[model samples]
Target: VARLQERARLFLELATQRGLDTGLSRGSAVIPVIIGDSALSLRLADRLFEQGINVHAISYPAVEEHKARLRFFITTLHSPDQIRFTVDALATTLSELRQEALYITPTN
Candidate 1:
């Protein structure tokens, strides 16, 4: 649960920085950033469907279940530039969604 708590903290900080605006869409309202085989599970799908959360569910042929994810959460101490970079990285990495191949694959 420690990991989940830390991740939640990171996401809240990020969303706040993004100008949470009205406190809606800040915390658990849009989280858990589903990962692994858990993403394919019925429970998770139901939770997402029922909650209507804006989950960014990543799927296979892209990443295995263990890696397939809507990756969110970053350290609070990371600089704005660092956070921007991370966001940019995600945008580029997932650009296929936009029909723009910003990156063929993520680098190590």
Candidate 2:
């Protein structure tokens, strides 16, 4: 689980830094973003399927196939030590990805 949380944080931070449109909304107009194919919104539906909170991957036409992902969550329910461990794991994973920019930077 620790591994999962870090990946989530890293993904979240990258998304914010890129200013990619959540694409989860109707009025959005930013770099397209997606999760489960209904736009990016994941509130009530998420809570209802708490046990199924797998990933937030984007779909095809709008995105590509393998690009799809499931989402994991972090909350008060998890301990700080656990969160930190997961963060470290995510950093390691991101470093290994090699082909993608973690975030959009000028000249990137």
Winner by lDDT: 1
TM-score of each: 0.31, 0.31
Question: What local lDDT does model 1 show for residue 73?
Answer: 38
lDDT of 1: 0.44
TM accuracy, model 1:
0.31
25-86: candidate 2 lDDT, tens digit per residue: 32211123333333222332343244332333344554455333323354545455554444
Clash number by candidate, in order: 0, 10
In terms of TM-score, how similar is model 2 to the real structure?
A: 0.31
Mark the regions of model 1 whose C-alpha exceeds 4 Å error after superposition: 1-25, 28-68, 97-108
Clashing pairs in 1: none
Estimate every model's Cα lDDT from 0 to 1. 0.44, 0.39
lDDT for position 29 in model 1 = 26
